[model samples]
Target: MSVSSHLLFFFSSLGAFNGLLLALFLLLKKDKQYTDNWLAILLILLSVRIGKSVAFYFTPTLDKSILQLGLTACLLIGPCILAYVAQSTLNNLTMKRLTITLSCFTIATVITGILFPYQDYLALWQYWIYRGSSYLWLISLVVASVMYARKNTYKLALSKQLLTQQPVVVLAGSWLIWTAYFTASYTSYIMGALSFSLVLYLTLLLALKSKWQEKASTTQSKYQNNKLSTEQTTRFSNLLNNLIETEQVYLDPQLTLPRLAKRMSATHTQLSQLLNDHYQMNFKQFINTQRITKAKESLKTYPEMPVEEVAERCGFSASSTFYSTFKQQTGMTPNQYRTTEI
Candidate 1:
């Protein structure tokens, strides 16, 4: 075999091998949603690359038969992998609709290609349409993946970054390979380079997975540091409820940590520590939450009371603090909430 052919064989095999490993890892460790979906996508793309390599080896020329078959597979594989990734990452129905649309498009492309094989001009036109449509769909998938990653509630900061970055990298790499293959002459050198790049890309995905695991570990540690033991949490909750029920703490205009701690029969240091360590919030936020709860009740039951009256009745020192705290907790200002009720 020539040098280029040998390189193609090696890279093609490497791509296939890495893809198989990714697929197996995902299948075995299906507990992680992000890793599983990403691995599945890698597998699909690698499979398509493998098919393309084999097709090129068999067909010496890029004619109607080769173009038809290769383009059809490309169209099918790109969208299928994207849809699966989106579904797995977002866990939503949008992925399902995208998958269904891609599937229908793939079927139509295949039917048209098969039916018009002898009509070379028509076949080429159908091929370009399918390719253009698939490219647009791929771009949409990239955008959706980005939006999902940005808005996802995944607690690990690094995991979110990795999720956001990896998809764009993959899309860029795929575009480069597709552009090189279609715009330039078909050579084993170009094909091999693409295959090798894909292999490297897949290896980077493994790094991403490792980063995700590390982020998960950090998140668990943070959770442990912030969380209170069940017994302590329950005791704190009971004490908080009792303080609010008595209305003594609420009536104190200068309600401070030392005063509240004394009323609860706890030292200032102990109460401050409990509020900070257990609730992951400062004493002010904890107190504001209670005040907001009371204000909400007053708003519903006594609509005739002015907002300022409600704030003062709820133990808030100022209307500005009351409005800010209420909005932060309920995602609406006092006036907006009252309007909603009516």
Candidate 2:
């Protein structure tokens, strides 16, 4: 092997190793919800895919077998990411059907690959179909994530749940790493896999730090009040009510969980727990409900008010966003709701 190939093998191996570690950590992590499991599986599959790159550059003997394995890994990447995003944002039971459908697609593709396991076919399949699908699925998920974030009253809430960076930001970073890897690997550029490894390592570090922060926050909360007393809970609830009903704080377009918590004189965790335990909604959902209620009144009271202006008055960031959110919440557009109700 040349110097460049040696470098590729070493760095790509490093990335695969880091990814494996991250996957194990996430898999064994207790108390994880749906997104965590999906992310772990994504990491594992990605690790194997990178491992195939290492083999291609370094191990000419085991080329065909590992190529097939890598392509199989590639097949799962899209479906797994789509499932992860759906669970993370929508959190709906219907996503189970989506998962099943994706699984069927992956199985069918794998069966086809097995049936046509020749170098010519495999090369075409991997280069044209699977590689493109991997990037395309990730892009779709990224766009969905961006839309999900923008549609919410608090742009960062969903991101906080998924990644340390905003979902788009993280996905953007992932895309850059992927783009570099794709261009470099296809051309046999020595440094192509290097960027992917380093980015994966950085992501692992960020995820770990985020996890630690969560743990520390939970511990501190447990130590501080050791669970809210009945009186304290009532007081906090009342404060939240005053903030929402009296102050109408949800009218702010930039309303966020941390900001609202500050206004309530409560910790972010405490406020989050309050909503989760009591209202059974996250901050965005709770805030949107309030906004939708107020929007309905405006639409009814002033039928002449433009739908765009109504959305702005209701704290939506964009007119399009407002329409979508309003429709989502009430099952009717603002115009329809106005006509029907008035």
Candidate 3:
């Protein structure tokens, strides 16, 4: 009932609402689904956790139910982070067993929390132990994501564009900010305010950026507007298409926009505009399309070639990515598609 308590609740509610909207965007937005569904799940979990904090502070009776619900959501954070980062880096293992195990653990945890009082096993020491482990696990995922980005530099499309570190850093920063509230009790409300502010700012910023970047990128180049006339643009497009389709530039498996632009004697932005305007896709999507097209041809032309080889020859860094891209593009796995073709 204190003024400070009410303020923290209000701000936390704001953060929660922002997070919910973002999760909805990920679920239903028209961006054509570049991000994995796991990211949306992660955001939902996070929104619940943030909202739970507000409930915890507002409820004078200190409801164990609200606290336990947040704990349950928190438990899955590590696994989801690992799964998302792994998939983002082109290491898209289904990890079904791991998911099942985590699910069971979450269920068991919820049951235990309900059966026992929060004061019993969920003491200060126990809470810190779990929180510490969760932080470590998250840090490990961030490090692993960065390491994979480095090691698989050639795996540009999936490895680099899968997940950016901005969200991860924001996640870590929010954790530390919220954690500081407990350590520095005198500044609890202040830290809570700061945490909620960061969440709202970053969440809205991301949504706006996502919604507007296509438009922004469209006008980003003067060359795209009028530097090249229609005929010139057509010629460049033809040349670029010929270069990739006939010369097989995509076979390198690391054919980024910059590399393609260099080969075409055009700037990166120009190439981006060319693809965006001509193909209605970003550079990565365009490249992946070419790869998938090549994969389809290979499947029928060289029926004896292993699917793995076909994946590599088609410029996919991993067979998993190949199958996923192929399935996503054609609605069938490579083997299934091959069967239908032959």
Candidate 4:
């Protein structure tokens, strides 16, 4: 192989290898969540499919069964993407429903592979299964995008929303872009592998940058002798209370310090200072306090409601966080607090 071809092979194959390794790590992770498992499955499927593309682009005589496996991986990718989106955003997909849906698709793929056997049915596999799987990927991406927008209240313009640095949004957008590349006839077959490489590296860079910023923010003094005046402090205090109590912005699990500061027509630094000096807490603590208070009320008023539902209603994001925070604040578990009364 020429140096250029070797470079292309290296560039594309590196991502697939790294993706498989990452997927294995996620699978073996002790503290992984449902969404994490789905994400791991997604990485595995994408890596397999992309690896097939890289191999087939260089070697025309690749095994038929390998081709079939790659396409079957494509068939499974859509469902995995959809499941990840649903579990991450809505958190309402029951394990039973997920199992049934994936099982049906897996069974169908296995049966079709057995009967058609791409070695003999190359035309059918290339024309029908390939196109069908690509379209399924596209449709899944569109549906997942709609679901995310609806559930997450993504109201920004298309350009702005796509430009947002949120991980889930970025993942969906990257998949959509990859699907477009593969579905278009003009694009090279190897472009999908290249695209995955680019996406993976970009995601890693963004993640590292985010962590660095978080560490920098923590190490540096946020306010650094910044203090609000008495009158300014009083006015801001009332506004903050109204925003939390009357508007109940704390009910949004996606609410962040910067978002709340924007709602208050203040800068995050100013808001942070006020929260620290006046409330004796930081943004997360203050928000969790409000959420815990709301949870306490719900637990008392609705004894029959499931703890998970209560956690969701109270903006806890995850039941584990809710349980921990409830215990920390009230010196008891939510159930104990509920049953013990005042």
State each model's CA lDDT, in order: 0.61, 0.71, 0.66, 0.80
Residue-level lDDT tens digits of model 1 in 1-342: 789767766665666566667667777774765335644655655555555555556555645565455455555555654654464343223445676776688678778777766245654555565567457546755665575455333322444344334444455455555555555455552463355457457658767885796567446545454445677667866887787776446543346675576556555555666888777778888888777877888888888888877876676655677788899899999989988876
lDDT of 4 by residue, 136-237 (tens): 887888787787777556334335324444536445545754665576578677888888887778777766876786567555546455678998799889
lDDT of 2 by residue, 164-274 (tens): 543443455556655766577465643435665877767768878877976776677776753666776798899999888887888766577866876677887788888
Each candidate's number of clashing pairs is 0, 0, 0, 0
* Candidate 2 backbone collisions, by pair: none
Q: In candidate 4, list every pair of residues with a backbone clash.
A: none
* Model 4, runs deviating above 4 Å: 28-34, 92-96, 154-169, 222-239, 242-247, 254-285, 292-314, 319-342
| Decreasing lDDT order of the candidates | 4, 2, 3, 1
TM-score of each: 0.48, 0.61, 0.60, 0.76
lDDT of candidate 2 at residue 57, scale 0 to 100: 61
Steric clash pairs (candidate 1): none
